[model samples]
Target: MERVPLSVLDLATVRAGHSSTDALLGTIAVARAADDLGYRRFWVAEHHNMPAVASTNPPVLIASVAAQTRTIRVGSGGVMLPNHMPFVVAEQFAMLEALHPGRIDLGIGRAPGTDQMTAAALRGVSPYLTVEQFPDHLRAVLALLGDDRIDAGPTARLRATPAPESFPEVWMLGSSTYGAQVAAALGLPFCYAYHFAMGSDVDRALELYRSGFQPSPRFPEPYPMVSASVIAAATTEEAIYLAGPSRVMVQSLRTGRLGPIVSPEEAADLDPELPGTQYAGTAEEVVAGLDDLIERTGARELMLAGTVYDPATRQDTLARIAKAWGM
Candidate 1:
């Protein structure tokens, strides 16, 4: 069988001793490495007021990464639909598609990527749609991007502006079943946040997505990608050691006190069991884990997400995994 394609989801993690500039540069470096290593997609996330994450605006980062890389697809891990108008998102992604042509993707999510107060600031009295209205907004974006199946209602008269000959591929991103249902009904590709939810509801979400999938012109069949936290090193012990910062970060998040990602040395004293189900081991061992994940979830693609503090180590891990996966 052909090897399953691998992708990456990077948060431009800011380390304890590194500046945000360093974090942004690290993202570019990783994207370059992924592109050179023959990865399929490289997605950046959007988070506001998070010291550890520097990928605040995806389009800007996508443009930068796309410009630097040669072949890997660049896109948002997600742009929270509730945080911006459909037209606004459509316009940004439309422009990206025009510039990058076939190398752009627009992944949409429902929840705001930040606190409610920050979300309010992002909406800025523009009559932001509630989370309940996300499906409607997603449809509107699709319509603006030329998905004629959508009625678009009042959004019909609007255009994303500077429309291109092609549109960016749209994917629904979620950690729960609602996103799965929406993506299936709309006939769009879906990416389950398996890493964020710690492997919860993944089987149910993917099952629903495939069973209820309705084909659309852009996406004729169900395409599901599972996001997983992974770390690959020369030895299982080394991989576990490298995962220290991620464990600490997860613990901090659980306590509602997110902070900059600390070095592994700094996180040595923290509890090591709070993080999600991450694949951390030698390349062959990690590949076995990924193979098991594929068998269990039946995902077409896997988006690897590792919160390692050092960019060089992160890039190295990707290379190791790619080699092991024969990509």
Candidate 2:
């Protein structure tokens, strides 16, 4: 069968309480496995101080994961741009592009990637980085990466050697309409955070993006990618069981209950059952959801993220979903 290009988002494991080092190493293994399985992209999320997530440093992790795999594309599900200096981002990603060549992606977001306290820790005395500065930061980063300035930095002097003859593909990651607008204005590919937000007006968001899409030096046309929260298993019941912890986590975010990630078993026991859930189902059901999503979002590419708990099981779930989607 021909391969359907599917990308993965690694927060990386959903197993509530493992050590960060272990989870990080495990995600590398999973990426290697997914690469071997012909997965399209393996992207890591930028989450700060989240006890449940191990991918705090996307660039470092991207390098590690990229070093461990071949063929599969690796990039950030997002690097919260508001937290870092754009030139630094350009330099780091340029390094990854140099090393990996033709296999790196740079998906960016406007949010701080954490709550106030955690944000303070990362930024420390720096003025709060808000959404307003996002566009400027984005422009600056791209300029450093692609612009031919008179006095370019050392890296920029040579168009940053090994620059793939092109920089990494830049994407805007959003959970709301503003992000859609920004991505559209830049004409770059947009990836929605349907995985967590389970947004109510998905269609409206897409409409905004397509309608506002303006060609930039970065994106010349409208290209959209979507990421979703999918839990696939042999059966609906099994998947739900696996999704227990994550469901609780989502509900926690939805309801303002915050802090550490709970184990799947703990979540299943504590939360009982989720109400009005969005991403829980069997392979067949999830495939149906993806089809509905494609029509509703008008997405050119779709990536299912936060899909499974265990590394091995995650691969199995993707394999099954790929078959079901006829990809």
Candidate 3:
């Protein structure tokens, strides 16, 4: 089988004993490691009002990561479109593309990335836009980035400045079929949130994307990428041990009691079977699992999303995976 390109998605998770600054620094360290290891892109996530996640603003984090790394693409794992105006999103990413031409990606999603109250706070009641308006908003952003498909919208009267010499690579991010349909109709790359959804509807969604796709100027072919959780260690036992914290994190998210990531020992004691799908094991085992995932999903790229308590250990996990994957 052909080798699939790999990328990294970081949440800048705040570990139990660390401050937000530490988490941010740790993310930069991971970006540098990914750059050196030849990872295709380094993307940061946006989650608001989450005590465990520090990446609330993706454009700012993208700028920081881009400044600190060389030759690695930097972007948002996504910026949730419902929380901000399409023009603002376009301008922020356009400026980023101008600063780091050919090295920026503008991943967009429809979810608010936070609880309802927080989402409401982000977008006030008056003049509020519904989630159903996401396609229009997405088209606005695309048109602002110079996509010709949307030439007569309100955005046509405006431009996202400092108009980049080249536009950022735009991707649609979702865990289900809504995003797939929109991306297919618009002819944009689609990234399935397999890491978060744990493979639910992934195959069906990708199939829907491929079958319904219409060719856009920028992307003539359907590009489906899977974002999955991964953990690599010297031994299978060690990898499972390291994945404990993520298990606890997922449990917390399910129960709405979000908190900082705890130590694996603490996590093991808290919840033994909190569900998640991770390609966790020794490096070779992880590689095999990833190959199987690619075969199942027909994904052209893989974006690994692994969160651990220790930042250095996270970097080591990525390095091990890269070495085993022969990248």
Candidate 4:
């Protein structure tokens, strides 16, 4: 089989002893590297009230990264659509598309990207929203983006301003079969969050997406992507050591105690178990694992999310992965 295109997903992780500013800077550096390496896309994630993650506002970060790099499609790995009005999301991405032209993606997700209380604060209301409303929210966003006609309150006939002739590509992001079904039903691209959903039946989700897919003007065929956590180093032992901090970060998140990502030494003390979503090994091992993942999920694209304590190590991981994949 032909090798699939590789992409990147970054959380702009704030490591121990580092400020959020440092993490954001590191993100730009990573974006430049990914662009130079010929990666297909560079995506930033959104998370609120999390000290470990610095990418709370994906559009702002996307603008910043897009300014620093000339290529490598910049976008939200996704924006949690439930946290804001669909109109605002549409305007923001429309502006981004107008500025960047053919290099913007608007990956949308249903999760709040934070705890219930924090989500309520972000949404400026009591927390009552559910993921079941995602399809409606998505449709509203599309309508505002000029894909459909919806009654605009007060300004009942206005379209989202600066709506470029070419709009950003929209991809649905999810960790469950429901997201797959929604993407297939809507005829949009689907990106499975395999990096975070360690135990999810990704193959089944992709199969469901393919089986239920209905062709639409935006997508003539199903375009499926899978995101994974990877750590590629010179050797398997070194890779495991390099992945220590990420393991600790995952454990903290799992336990609802998310905080600054720790150093390798601190992570070593915790000795957290490696999550199934993560693959920490030599470049060859990572390549083999990625091959298996592609075969199983039949994903046309692969997104690598590597959150390590050191920016240099993270860059090295990307470099090694790119070389192994011959990108």
Candidate 1 residue 318 Cα shift, in angstroms, is 0.6
Q: Give candidate 2's root-mean-square deviation (CA, Å).
A: 3.3
Cα deviation at 136, candidate 3, in Å, is 0.7
Q: Is candidate 3 or candidate 4 better by lDDT?
A: 3
Better of 1 and 2 by lDDT: 1
Clashes of 2: 1
| Model 2 lDDT, residue 73, Cα | 92
Instruction: Give the TM-scores of the predictions, in the order they appear.
Output: 0.97, 0.88, 0.97, 0.95
| Better TM-score candidate (2, 3) | 3
Ranking by TM-score: 3, 1, 4, 2
Per-residue alpha-carbon lDDT of candidate 1 for residues 90-198, written as tens digits (9 for 90 to 100):
9999999999999999999998988878888888743244677777888899999988889979988888978888899999999999899999999999999988896
Compose the digit string of candidate 4's lDDT tens values, residues 1-327.
569999999999999889999999999998999999999999999999889999999999999999899978999989998888887898999999999999999999988888898988887775566455677778888777777544444444656769698989989999999899999988899999999887889888999999999897878999999999999999998888888888887788778887898887887788998653288898889999999988888889999998788877878988998898888
Which parts of model 1 are misplaced by more than 4 Å?
125-129
Number of clashes found in candidate 4: 0
Name model 3 segments beyond 4 Å from true: 126-128
Task: Give the C-alpha lDDT of model 2.
Answer: 0.76
